[model samples]
Target chain A: MDRILYGDNQFFAVNHISDAKSMEQSMKFKENDAIIATLDQAIEAGIDTFMCTTHDRIAFVCDAVRSNPEKYKDFKIYPCMPYAHKYANAVTELGIQGTIKQYVPGNFFGSMFKGGKALVSKDYLAIMELLVDAEMKMFEGVKTPVVFLQNVITDLLLGLGMDEILKGFHDYVREKYDVEPGFITMNLPKLAETLEGLGIENPIICASINSANFRMSGGKELYEETLRTKKIRVIAMQVLGGGAIPPKEALGYVCGLPNIESILFGASSKRNIDNTVSTIHEFDSK
Target chain B: MLRVALVGAGKMGLSHLSILGAHPNVEVVGVCDTSLIVMGALKKYTKFPCYKKFTKMLDQEKPDAVFVAVPTKLHYEMIKELLDRKIHVFAEKPFCLNPEQGSELARLAEEHNLVNQVGYHNKFIGTFKEVKRIIESGALGEIYHFTGEAYGPVVTKKKDSTWRSNPADGGGCLMDYASHVIDLLNHLISPVASAEGTLLKSIYSQHVDDAVYSLLKLESGETGVLSVNWSDDTYRKMSTSVSITGTEGKIISDASELKVFVKKEGALDGYTKGWNVKYVTQLTDQVDFYLRGEEYSAQIDYFVNAALKKGPNDINTFKSAARTDNAIALIKNNSKTKA
Candidate 1:
């Protein structure tokens, strides 16, 4: 992961604080051109690594990046999987079978048989891999060095006592996709502990690391303790607490923390991106 | 009489409730939904108690079986809990969100020896069933290729905030409508061996897909194509059809009719073997209660009967639905790779 990775939350209508703003952003970025323009702006400011959800629209963005290779030649994407909402909407419309058929990789029969076998044999790891591959489909021919699981399925699986799937994900991404597997969770400390239990040393985990502790489960103190002691890579997100914390103050608080190798944030404008990037640089130098 | 409780009071749930209520061999113990407004409206029609919580309904009713028509995301946990309590389950399509949950539930059902069925009512449609029979009887000999299509006018515009449009809630045209077509393909043709050239496009809804297209290869040396669009307002109603081509004949089927074209005349089901057309009404099962089609009632009756061990417990097992899930997984994966 890059020291500063651009996120896709702004393009996908995700607002932690206001639904109205989220809706507005969704409408604004509904067009691929708008999204590309913003990405280009970020690139102009020297932030090239994009940590994005595997939303359907991102496929169009990937197309933009692939077609203009010179523009994004050094750019990279970190795809998050099971874009829960994508799967949910897909299942709602296409049904489970159709959803799987639509997203699962390989020829129809082989993938179906693999899916069927996974279903019958309870080989959820295979299903998880299928979903990961499906989500990564858009990033084909694009550079994806880090693939992470979204917090939706991450926390769900964590709560379900299905940490083995997490380990399986880590291994699958490493072996099959040849990318570092990252896990995003609301409970950073717990996820770290779970990953360690599976013998995943120094795992890459992304979570909320902010002064306000907005949406940070298990509190701030535990996260700091885990970061200091866990020997894992940390990507601090929601550093602004969904806009509750000011940019400079939030960056100062998080940049001062230990073991945070990277910072992930989403901004729709060049000013916000430049300001956030510069602020982090200023705080880091201090 | 087997006592049954219903979870989810939405469109499909209500449909199940209607048939379950009228069945003489079954008792509708209760209905449950998260919405008081929906439960209230449902309460007006039936004396069966309504509750907001499923656990309370289950504890109070102690129904022998549960019919789940909830969202796909809710299927795994709810069905797992019911199966844990040794309750038979007949859930609506898309069995579970993914194969893992489907497998777990299937294993639970098998371990409990409970009768389980997924609501692939298209399999119960007379013309489709006839299509299956014709193919199984070697009428469409040495089948080589098939195509399944489903079109409707569900999400032509911006959809309301419902589970049907929310991806987190497992709502999308690919899952909702295309699942039927995929299941039909699994039932009539051979199981999908591989799929390519797949696309899941969203025209109107931001989250859910409105259109899907796929090219598939079946395990039995056959090929398939699936094209579905839930946002197609040009169609008056939801139309699902399948066309199969083989060495001996071809069968084209829709909701109301099955058209067969054979290379030679052979006495199979009293057909001349050349361009034989059969209306769904002619092939449909005679039933006491009919709403939409007898397939709904037929599927329900089959589950209820199978639950009571009065007949073979083979409708559409979770394993079978899991096969559809498998095919879907392949199609989705193929589409993504190609994209």
Candidate 2:
């Protein structure tokens, strides 16, 4: 993960605080051009890493990057898998089989047989691999050094005690795609403990770490303690608590934390991107 | 005896379970479902070990064959792993959601030399089997046109919440109902070479089609029409019928009976063919135990026996199912372009 990774919440209508803002953002980014322009703005401001979900439209963004490889040579993407809404909508539109056909790359019949056999044999890890492949399909030939499991599935698997799958994903990504695997979760402390128990030392975890503790699960104190002690690379997200906290104060609070390797934020305009980047630089210098 | 297990405890899963469990040559090893409620219900019918996680079941039971009736979305990966494990699989139709997946699975099954079958139970229906026999015999010489109709009351109202109403889950009348018609058409006539004049209408579901109509041209040069509506509430129950017209005669067949008419004698077996009706009861095989439809059991039995190398591996193989998938892809593409 980069020191300042651009987030995709603004590209998709994902607002933790307001439905109105989410709807507004959804309308604004309805066109791929708008998303591309914003991404270009982020790149112009020296933010090279674009951490994003595998939304259907992200395929267009991946194409944009691939088309002008020279311009985005230093750029990178951290793809998150099982974009729940995408799969849900695809299921509603294409049906499961059709959804797999549309999303999963490779020969259709071969993939279908693969999918069918995985399901029958209860080889869910293989299914997860298929999904990961499906999500990463668009990023072929693009620079993607890290792949993150979205918190939606990460937390669900956590709750389900599916540690094997979590570890399996890490191993698969490293062995097959040759990328570092990252996990986003609401409960950082528990995740750290879980990863360490699985012998995954110094795991990279992205979670909410802020002054107000707005969306930070297990409270701010616990996250602080884990950051101070755990052998993990922490990526601070939602530092502004969905814009409840001021930017400078939020950046100051998170930047002052120990072992904070990255800060991920989303902004729709160049001005916001510029200000956030400058603020982080100022804090880093101090 | 062949050891078998089942994943998915839904309607189809239970159907497969009942037949597999009762079969004389099968030993039901395990049943797995994500839902405890579903697995709990399954426990009443069989004392086999139940599991919420499929991998656990597979690891513990290690069955020689597995029957999968999970959502269509889950077919590809599941089928792939089963093939890798060398476990013969009997999957529910449509074999896959798309042509690519269907073809891939077909290829893998052939490569692995595995006995793979899709749940196109209509093929096993007595009337349908007789219809296929008549067509293969060329009783209806120079077949020129055919029509297929399937109607039911599965989605008469808004069904936005269920997987069947969702396209990703392989929901909608087109994939669910029209697929059967397409398979039957492929069996009786020939693989659909081109499909046109498609109408995919949604009466109750916003995502998937509730009614589907299409014009098809088979590779055998036979023209056909398919009309299927899951939203139609007037039908007393689900009804699917096919009528084929040829140079010498015509035949109309449904689940219950097959009616044939011939202009010349000796056109079909044991029939002068002025107008003859053969009820399903008269044509069906005598079975010791049955549920839902004998065709369902027949398909399962065929797969198991095929897996045991006692029968020919010719029961709706993935290759055959891929043809239906191709027809579906064509219909869907045509409908989208027109829309």
Which DockQ value does candidate 2 get?
Answer: 0.01
User: TM-score of every model?
Assistant: 0.54, 0.55
**C-alpha lDDT values of all predictions:** 0.79, 0.81
TM-score of chain B of each: 0.96, 0.97
Top candidate on lDDT is: 2
- lDDT for each residue of candidate 1 in A174-206, tens digit (9 for 90 to 100): 999788999988768777887888899898999
Fnat for each model: 0.01, 0.00
Q: Weakest 10 consecutive residues, lDDT, candidate 2 chain A?
A: A115-124
Tens-digit lDDT string for candidate 2 (A1-286): 6799999998787664443466588789889999999999999999999999887788998899989989999999999886866554455444545566666656644643554432422335566688788778889989899899988666545643457778988999999998899999866877888899999979889987888764455567778999999999999998887776789999999989999999999988789999999999999999
Off by over 4 Å in 2: A1-286, B43-45
- Error (Å) of candidate 2 at residue A186 is 55
What does the lDDT read for residue B268 in candidate 1? 66
Alpha carbon lDDT at B314, candidate 2: 85
